[model samples]
Target: MALRSNPTLRQRRLGAELRRMREQAGLGGSQLARALGINPAHVTQMESGKTGISVERLRTIAALCMCVNEPLIEALAEIITDRDKGGWWEEYRGRLAQHFLEMAEIEYGAHGLSTYTMAFIPGLLQTTAYASAVFARGFPRLPPHEVDLRTAFRMKRQHVVRSGKTPYSAYIHEAALRMQFSGPKVQAEQLGSLIEDSERPSISIRVVLFNVDTLPVNHENFTYLEGPIPELDTAQMDSGLDSMLYDAPAHTAQFRSLLKRIDSAALSEEESREFIQSIKKDMERNYG
Candidate 1:
């Protein structure tokens, strides 16, 4: 069996909470270990996210820390238990990075998701052909099979939007609507697909037009996910080199501000549909 590489987000969060509780109780690792009848090193490992904690141990620790809220304790316990089990993405483990896997799991668990794209369509909305073309261009040296696997993974993620599990909102730039990474035909198809998907009750698509002077043009891609707990809301920013996930209140607030700016600059639903249809007509005329 493959050894676990590092603690997942859930594990990390739980570990942080445990450490916080211990510190609040004014107990050091050794003291807590003695009180719980566990080894100091074991307690240290759990606090550092280097070791997993069982449900029973978690309850004992919570009680020892004077935690009275059953809901919060249960939530933390769920994170520990859930992390131990394999998620559906485990099947595609070798093909995708750990960050992408974590994002996929979080997306599945989110109650709502909002995205802003400046360059290209977000992966969740891209058609297979569009996704393939984008991946091919970005990874020119990648093998065809690898590109195919990436496309498949992206396609699978779109289910979250199609199904009613999580509501999603997207704000896209007008440039992206006109940009043709693949041939015009593929681009046109992608735009049409977006329009159709946007009509879904759980999906909202708004386009920031070129004439919108209020729009912020800092070219960055971001995704914000909201879960059952307010603290679980997170924002992800793409830095070209890598993606960074932010959960700090300040960072999340900044993302929320950016999203609001984009939303304010974007065309309304009817206007966006008209704009997309106009672009599709032009693509047909030029390419067909």
Candidate 2:
């Protein structure tokens, strides 16, 4: 079969895990190639995500590599099937950066998610108007068509928090609530929408008041996407005009720790709701 021209993140991840397992077992590509009865180049191709490997072959590879993480192996098998499924995000392939589609796929498979934002409401919780305002303020200033497309794409990403079972916690700074992105009317709607989304059983909204001192990971906005297995988890953050996904153990651990500390600095759920209510009332008094 012709190799994939552009492999998805999950595909690449599966290959990476296999490569790690092989190295841990002290097995070279030639040794594995001879074991699998394929050329050494073929093993290299699989490790690079240039070609798909059958589940049976993957299991054989694991056995040869002496890998014993059953759960992780199962997750890798599931990722194999996932690559075959052309998700809804496929429709926007060439229109937006590949990062957007990869993000959607990552969130779709996430068992849980935690987001931290200093300058804007979390994307998954944003209402259409709020998203439009946020996108409008981007550098180079997007045209109306692109803004609408981004808004639609963002709204679709909310499905994981809405209909799916992925539990999500968003730690938002108070400044974002007062930014007044579009105007009073739009801001009011956004505050109202935030209140509504916070009520969802799967969604947790926590506010890190401006007064909160020394918040964690204060440098930028990011989302921590949790996988079924710890080894498979990833952390995503914006890098320039694109998104960067981090799956290295150290990076993932740092992100997880950052979240724990951020949660420590944030208001409790009930307190956050009350805090948002006050913000909304303030908005109504000033904007309405």
Candidate 3:
């Protein structure tokens, strides 16, 4: 099989997990290659996600590693067998950045989602008009047509949350509510949309008030995507034009702790709704 020149995030993650299992089992690359009757370079390629692994090979590797964690093995199997081909994001492959497609793939497969935003509304909750306005602010100034295309892609991405099958929790800082990225009208409409979305059974919206005793120092915008098992969970962080996904156990655990702190400081669902309404009314009263 031809080696993959550009493996997706999921593929790379599977390779990392396999390497971890081997390390835990106290085996070297050459030893594993010898046991599997393959060249040592093949092991290197598999561990780096440059080559694919069959279910049989994966199971054999698990046995060689003496890994008895059934749940984790199943999770790895799922990644190996995933045939989504980037899911709905495939259509935008050449049109949008590869990062967007990878992010969508992970989002679609998440069992649950938790997000915290300090400067803007969560992408899944932003209305079309609001999304357009947000996109218009892109650096280097995108042409009008490009902005429309990007906004449309973002709106479509929201379907994962709108499907109402995946549980989602969005924690937005109070300051984000007041930022008129577009204008008063768009901002008010976006807040109103958020109010309606909060009513959805599968969606939870919380507001982190400015008056909280202490806020986390790490305010980077991030979304924690829960995998089928805790071991596969991922934390996606976005900064400017870069998007980073961290699935290492330690990193994911730290992100989980950060989310817990944000949740504790945020208002309850009912209170968040009222708070949003108040902000919307303020926007209208001041700029109507």
**Per-model C-alpha lDDT, please?**
0.82, 0.88, 0.90
Best by TM-score: 3
Ordered list by TM-score, greatest first: 3, 2, 1
Q: What tens-digit string does per-residue lDDT give for candidate 3 at 1-288? A: 899998887888899999999999999999999999999999999999999999889999999999999999989998888833557788887898889888888898899999998889999899999889888987889999988998898898899999897899999998899988888989999999999999999999999998986876475589999999999999999978789889889999999999888888899999999999999998888777
**Clash counts for the predictions, in order:** 0, 0, 0
Worst 10-residue stretch by lDDT in candidate 2? 211-220
Q: State the TM-score for model 3.
A: 0.97
CA error at residue 179 for candidate 2, angstroms: 1.8
Where is model 1 poorest over a 10-residue stretch in terms of lDDT? 1-10
Question: Highest lDDT, which number?
Answer: 3
- For model 1, residues 1-288, the per-residue Cα lDDT tens digits are 232357776676677778877887888999999998988987877876778878999999988888776776777777876776776777887777777787787788787999988789988999999999888887445688888988898898889988867889988888888888888899999989998988899988998877878666464588999856665568888886577888766777777888887877788988988888999889988788
Query: Of models 1 and 2, which has the larger lDDT?
Result: 2
